[model samples]
Target: MKSTSTLLAPEEEFPTALSELPVLEIHVLHSRVCRQLDHEYLTDPAGAHPVTLDRHHELVAELDDRDAA
Candidate 1:
């Protein structure tokens, strides 16, 4: 097997907030959370934890707010 990393290059500064990230990065994060929620639903449909859902909502709201501005 081989190993890979997603770490940024040393000269690349990581964004401190979602608002600071590029559009593609934001989409990737949203996609990741959606996938997580899907898995959580599969394992426990009735009582999935609220944290993931909250994050999803937050991302959506941020995008909406950005679009509105």
Candidate 2:
């Protein structure tokens, strides 16, 4: 698998909390969490909460809009 570092350019600004870690480490963490979320959803699609996902999507959209500005 290509490292997460390959997905993002070097000049990209990471979240402040992750600034101290190597970009590869941050990517690994993101990949692991996404995999875990996917597994959880697969095991119990209805059991998983929707509100948090909705909020996440909203936030992402807002961020995208900001970036596009």
Candidate 3:
């Protein structure tokens, strides 16, 4: 799949890390991860990838930090 970042100019490249993403981007990613987890839960209730869960936790922490600020 083509990333939207490809359309950006050289000066407008997307950040490579979750911590570097803007709040809006973080929210979008967080929501996408949640949907993936929900799908996994429906398909295999006994298994959800630890990496994905870790990412969700990271995004949540970033959001929480932003809110506290």
Every model's TM-score: 0.66, 0.41, 0.71
Candidate 2 global TM-score = 0.41
The most accurate candidate by TM-score is 3
Model 1 misplaced regions, further than 4 Å: 1-16
Model 3 segments more than 4 A misplaced: 1-16
What tens digits encode model 2's per-residue C-alpha lDDT throughout 1-69? 344542222233334444455556554545544454465477775743454344334434544555586
Model 1's TM-score against the true structure: 0.66
Ranking by lDDT: 3, 1, 2
| True-vs-predicted CA distance for residue 9, candidate 2, Å | 28
* lDDT score, candidate 3: 0.63
Ten contiguous residues with the weakest lDDT in model 2: 5-14
Task: State the lDDT of candidate 1 residue by residue for 6-67, as single tens digits.
Answer: 32222333234778777777776666667767776788858445777776787787788788
lDDT of each: 0.62, 0.46, 0.63
Q: Pick out the ten consecutive residues of candidate 3 with the lowest summed lDDT.
A: 5-14
lDDT of model number 2: 0.46
lDDT of 3 by residue, 1-69 (tens): 124431222222324576676787777776666876776667776866676677668778889988998
- Total clashes in model 2, counting residue pairs 3 or more apart in sequence or in different chains: 0
- TM-score order of candidates, top first: 3, 1, 2
